[model samples]
Target: METNEVFEKVKGLFVEDLGIDESKVTMDAKLEEDLEIDSLGIVEVVMAFEDEFDIEIDDEELADVSTVGQAVNLLHSKI
Candidate 1:
């Protein structure tokens, strides 16, 4: 899928599923710091992404995915 498509999907997951504010789901927003998603929350997010894209995401692969852009890029690459 395209990067923008992945971004929109991720944003939807954050807003609809994760209960994050829509305005705070920007590309530069930090998933933990900016969005207030803790470790468990990150796990929830990873699971959500995996389910949405029908792909599995390794925890090791997500080591450096700190921001929304990084997550979207990772998912886009996977898709």
Candidate 2:
């Protein structure tokens, strides 16, 4: 999928699953700062991503992804 498609899919997932506000979910949004996603939430996000994209992301690589754009970029690179 394209980057915008990925962003929209993940954004919906975050809103439906995490109860994140739509206005707060932006491309530059920081997972911790904007979404208030804690450690467990991070894990859940990763899991949701894996399920959404049908790809696996190692735990080590999770730290490198801190923004919505980063997640889209990473997903783009992988899938």
Candidate 3:
């Protein structure tokens, strides 16, 4: 999938599942700090991404994914 596609999908997941404002789901938005997603929420988001993309995401891989851009990049790599 394209990077933009991954970004859009991730953004949608954050909006639908986490109830985040769609306007705040920008590439630079911080999942924890900006979006106020707790650790458990992060895990759930990761799982949702995995299911959405049909790809496995290890915990270690998620360690550095703090921003929407980072997550989209990771998803792009996995795809």
Q: Which run of 10 residues does model 1 get worst, by summed lDDT?
A: 1-10
Model 3: per-residue Cα lDDT over 1-79, one tens digit each? 7899888898889899878999999999998899999888888998899899999999999888889899899999989
lDDT of each: 0.93, 0.90, 0.90
lDDT of 1 by residue, 1-79 (tens): 7888889999999999989999999999998899999999998998998899999999999999999999999988888
Q: State the local distance difference test value for candidate 3.
A: 0.90
Taking all chains together, the TM-score of candidate 2 against the true structure is: 0.93
Better by lDDT, candidate 3 or 1:
1
Superposed on all Cα atoms, the candidates' RMSDs to the truth, in angstroms, are 0.6, 0.9, 0.8
lDDT of 2 by residue, 1-79 (tens): 7889888998999899889998999999999988999888998999998998899999887778999999889988888
Per-candidate TM equals 0.97, 0.93, 0.95
- lDDT for model 1 comes to 0.93
- Tell me, by lDDT, which candidate is best: 1
